[model samples]
Target chain A: MKVKAFLLGVLALAGVFVGFDLQNSHGTSFAAKKAANYDESVTLPMAKYPETGKHIKDAIAAGHSAVCTIDRGGAADRRKESLKGYPTKPGYDRDEFPMAMCKEGGKGADIRYITPADNRGAGSYIGNHVENYPDGTKVLISVK
Target chain B: MNKLLISYSQLIITNTDEEHSSFQWSDEDVKRGYSVQRGAVAIEAINNDESEIEVIVGSYLPSEKATVTYSLPFPVRADSIIVTSPGAVTLPFSVPKGTYQLHVEAIPLQQPTDDGLFPVRYQLYFDTNGSK
Candidate 1:
């Protein structure tokens, strides 16, 4: 209605997107800031860090797609399951494709040995970014 | 400060010594573009942004300057040219069979755009002309 529009205009004038409360399927209200800034999907730059990049490609090719799923919780459990059989090496870290945080990850995920610099750095870069996104999100796994 | 880069692709190049020989990978010659009627396999790899790339000739350990580097121990037969990037540009070059290291330098040469894809430029260090 025109009245609602006027109220929104007044709120926006006072502060950007203020008082913009919207309900979701769960019946919880979301702040206007979050409502306006939701990332539908994320892209994991496989080639951004080529060492970890190659491992991701090879792991997917080896049959692990959950690597594309974002983890909502239980990352420690997933890591334990996916890395159970792969022992750590002196110069290498056991890298899992469907990383621990991904919903599709854990237990039976493809594991590869890669350098720590590659494994840790790329993981943190993406982990830091996606931590802002909610759990159970599907991310686009891409190379180059 | 650390530099910002977009992509780091692991490229594979295959080379068959001859018609009836097993493939032994490594080194080669050429600078740009791909030849349809070619002797070596036309190879491709992924890069995120169309920033600038640095192609070096010779078999050396990976360089620290490169944003990302990998080894392609497959056979390569580039007696002519190569196609790189997101099909933006082509260059001519050549390499044969042997384990070789490839370095990808993805420094932004221009301002990035909204949608993320962009054009690319390159710099070549040394020549692998008749390089093995």
Candidate 2:
């Protein structure tokens, strides 16, 4: 009876070890499968630049400007649009406004444009153009 | 004890137009007009391994709907390190005024490599309006 009990105890210990090994292998296999199927793709829509407005061109030609008072809701979008490229050339009769002056408080709009600097150094400029109006005032930006 | 290290990286914009100048960017300078017509990106890396490794540099512009991918093989000797200070690779296409995410990955050419090896990624904003 003593020998039989000893043999049973050894079998139980062996079974425990085998179970632990199986669990570890299964976990590793699961992790490897997950890593093998990793997806590294990023998708984004094509960016569209705003078109030049006919009125804006007319104003610029006439040495006048049109201003859009960017309401609070439109402030963030306007700020983003302001960072976009200046129309390659001002559109003569287009219906969209791609470039504009951005103002916060009673200060001038921050106008940014691509610089002609070397490729090894910085290549853009951000200059502030103070408008002669109070905060929340609409200012028109035009090329004279 | 083998590893890959990214030592340095930078994004450069070169504008051909004279009406604009480049300015350093600040965290609070999110109000835009910043723009760039061309971008040259450079990355430096080192391999501290006994075997050859592959390095991949990828740039993804979600808003502009563009992705750039390039790969190079790096050879390293046992008990020795390989350092690379590669020149900037000019993008074939212009990086329009928008934000972009850049990803870099390195892996050993041999099998039995760790899945979580060398990976790095970051975000950048570009504008044709010249805000650096």
Candidate 3:
């Protein structure tokens, strides 16, 4: 009887451990989504020569600019943000964002990556919310 | 540990100085005229920075048929004028041409602080091109 009770207790402990492991796995995806959140930062590539034409850093900045224009609502359907050829341009580069992120269940707001044909860029629907702003709102930003 | 923190600070400052700059607009200013049938106008403010720019567009409505008022944020000079819709639009001290007037202006930006970020806003007003 003592041995049987010990086995039953061990099984219950194993079940709890498995449940904890599953919960942790789900938490990792949420953390990844948060990590991908948009924050203002300039990107530059490592380069040895300043005289080099369009170094990697300059190229990276330009690439992000193209990717930031596709955040318009109702227009970003079936679109994606390309991260290919990121450090170098004039060469073929391809990227695609998860389609699930653009769906209704996704957290995509009024701004995001859109179809490549429509300028192949990102966009925002800021003008749609102009009604909520004050009469004289201004903003200054420094990017690096 | 103290030395490591100091080294990190040095790296951040050096990186920031080498890699950052403020965004300037493609054009110094944009100008548009308003007239009859033109109730509003829209203008785009370019954000050269990596972040989004929160800006506002608006103008004071005219009170008289031949009178015109300036926008809150005065422009340095007038440039190319496009008809937003249809309204009487005249430059500062210039003659008003039609029954109504329209003008598009960029207000100050509400910058985002450590506390929170502000959304961009725009306002549109119409005028009968009248004098007060």
Candidate 4:
């Protein structure tokens, strides 16, 4: 009778352990950049260009569709906040691609328009800088 | 040659009959500690066929003394604000529910030589309280 009681107790303990593991089991939870519940409603930083500025007017008028109007109001709110650190080795700058421009043939069409980090030292922007939106942000580029 | 300016912003508004009930946005209003001013041009769209929309841009100095305004032609809007200083400027303003054009302007305004511009980037809030 004692042996049977011991066996039942062991089974019950095993079942509890299994249940706990099941509750925590979700696929690929080890990934570094998964969006959290807090990341749901985020405001992205966006830059706007005015036609009055010389280079901007020239760029937009030159048919370079990548250049568009800037909304400084959007940029002001997004100035220099901590970003989710990506997996990176020390001393190496983070590899990033600006969210593709919508005007022309999607992305990969024009390389000249892209401002490289090497030429413009990482974040040293000479003129108006548009904070690149992270992947998966709903974007709206329009003409009014 | 272009100049670098910081600590300022270009207020873009889509005004109707009253001119106050419109959506306005800028970058210089928020980048605090760094000088925020007009920088480079982003884009320009012109309507040769007919008068479409008008864009008006002006520089808003945060303080009471230094006056600055770079108003654009009617209908030509701004998309970006150039950072005149090495850092950032922040502005906070509200927009009414309406379709509008946008742009930014920035110019680096400080060297080791000049006095630093405004402090603290402007935080955007609806004009329900009134302008500061």
Candidate 5:
């Protein structure tokens, strides 16, 4: 009798966990219908480059909405338009959000100058995650 | 009786920054979805980490259960909308092709989640006869 009771208790406990897992997965409408696929999270290295972080935080603070779409078309033209009169400093690179590759990027986009290492590092990290994502793919920039 | 097309208990949203504050439907996408008619909705003050966005299609408009409401002038173009900030995703809802009158409601939950997540109920109703 003791052995049978113990087995039933364990089975009940296992069932509870399985139920919780299913409920969690189906909590979202997308998951309930079809597994939603997304590649929108991008991490920012704030500690590695405080200045770089400050520039982005400030731009976001000043009402420059982060445009999440990636266009990759007319990037050179957009970059040229935004950098027409911008000053470049020694040992620094000008970084902009709504990057020249984004459909939202162009003249008047947010621009910040930071070290080449920090600038390139950030760019590479973002590209690794979203390089192949289609245009208009929403992106979430996490300033960590 | 208004039929419930989609119901979501929790809608996740990533409040990336203050500037990216609203979740807007794509009018252009709507145009593509419908053969002759389409619609879209944009909800403001949606800084909440997550909120419930619910809509009804091909039925009568439901009762007023929102603090405020708005109707878009020109339709938006989008089969869906996506938002990603810290830990938010789109409340994925796909509607069948037809003309729609986009109605939205923003109900600020009296009690926000521990993470300060705001929940907004987006009720979009679609039926026939919405002019192009």
Candidate 6:
């Protein structure tokens, strides 16, 4: 009877360890799955050329798309702040890519146009950034 | 014979539309303190020429698909032996928040001789907040 009890206790410990490993593996797989489908939603407004904003408009009409349009208030600020600490994965540089956060009060929503080449895992990065935001915090992302 | 030369040019960014408080581009600024709060950028150009020179300013965000470009015609007078501008021509533009590489091409519209192109690359950091 003593021997059986000891073996049962050891088996229980092993089962706990297996459960923890499975949980960890599930978390990693979830992140990878999210990374694979990074496109969230189109938010960037139509891009306007300095001289002629027509090209961008026409392109939009023809199906050219903008990725994300973020609000310029506290929500936008939080998003920007979160992105600041976002770790640069392998083969990525924060400087090489242009990332503007416009704060013009009355000038509509701030738009960020990102191409596939520019945003390899932009969705995942953004998802990771907003992971800690309180419920109802708007986190918008779009891909082309 | 006159050579169109760009002696010195610096990219300045300001938070206010008034352009009173501005910061100059520095290596440290690019690495650590690069960010724009109000989305205003000023390109100060100094031309070394005896006469007026026409320059084209072209810029684009490396991560963005669209490019913003415009041209400027600068006038400079020559005095004594050295050619200098009466004052620096300030080109101001309202830019959205983002990291960008500004390329300025100063080509003499009137090139009697072969005065090679003077181009300068300035790294731009524009942020509404200090996120960049």
Clashes of each: 31, 18, 37, 79, 14, 12
- Please give the distance, in angstroms, between residue B32's alpha carbon in candidate 4 and its true position after superposition: 27
lDDT of 1 by residue, B1-116 (tens): 11112221112122333222111212221112111122333222222233344445654543344432322223244432342221112233554333333333333345533322
Compared with the true structure, all predictions reach lDDT values of 0.43, 0.28, 0.23, 0.26, 0.47, 0.30
Worst 10 residues of 2 chain B by lDDT: B81-90
Instruction: Give the DockQ-based CAPRI class for model 4.
Output: incorrect
TM-score for all predictions?
A: 0.37, 0.20, 0.21, 0.20, 0.39, 0.18
TM-score of 5: 0.39
Q: Which prediction has the highest lDDT against the true structure?
A: 5
Candidate 4, residue A87: Cα displacement in angstroms equals: 25
Which residues of candidate 3, in runs, are more than 4 Å off?
Answer: A1-57, A60-71, A74-144, B1-99, B103-117, B130-132
Misplaced by over 4 Å in model 6 are A1-144, B1-8, B11-16, B28-37, B42-132
Task: Select the stronger candidate by lDDT from 1 and 6.
Answer: 1
Indicate which candidate wins on TM-score: 5
Q: Is candidate 1 or candidate 3 better by DockQ?
A: 3
Cα error of candidate 6 at position A61, Å = 66
Model 4 reaches an interface RMSD of: 16.1
Candidate 1: interface RMSD in Å?
16.5
Model 5 lDDT per residue over A1-144, tens place: 999999999999998897678768767643433332333556676876566567777877777655466654455456556555655554455677656666666688787766644554455445445644776676656577
lDDT per residue as tens, model 1, A1-144: 999999988877766433332344324323422454433434556655677788777877777772355544455456556666555455455566776666677788877777644554455455434534556555656556
How do the residues B52-123 of candidate 2 rate in per-residue lDDT, one tens digit apiece? 223222332333221222222211112122221111111222333333333323232433222112233322
TM-score for model 4? 0.20
lDDT tens digits by residue: candidate 2, A55-83: 33453455432344433323333433433
* Candidate 1: segments with Cα more than 4 A from true spot: A1-39, A44-48, B1-132
In candidate 2, which residue ranges exceed 4 Å CA deviation? A1-56, A59-65, A68-137, B1-132
Q: Which one is best on DockQ?
A: 4
Task: Encode model 5's per-residue lDDT on B68-113: one tens digit a residue.
Answer: 5545332323444332221222234555443455545556655533
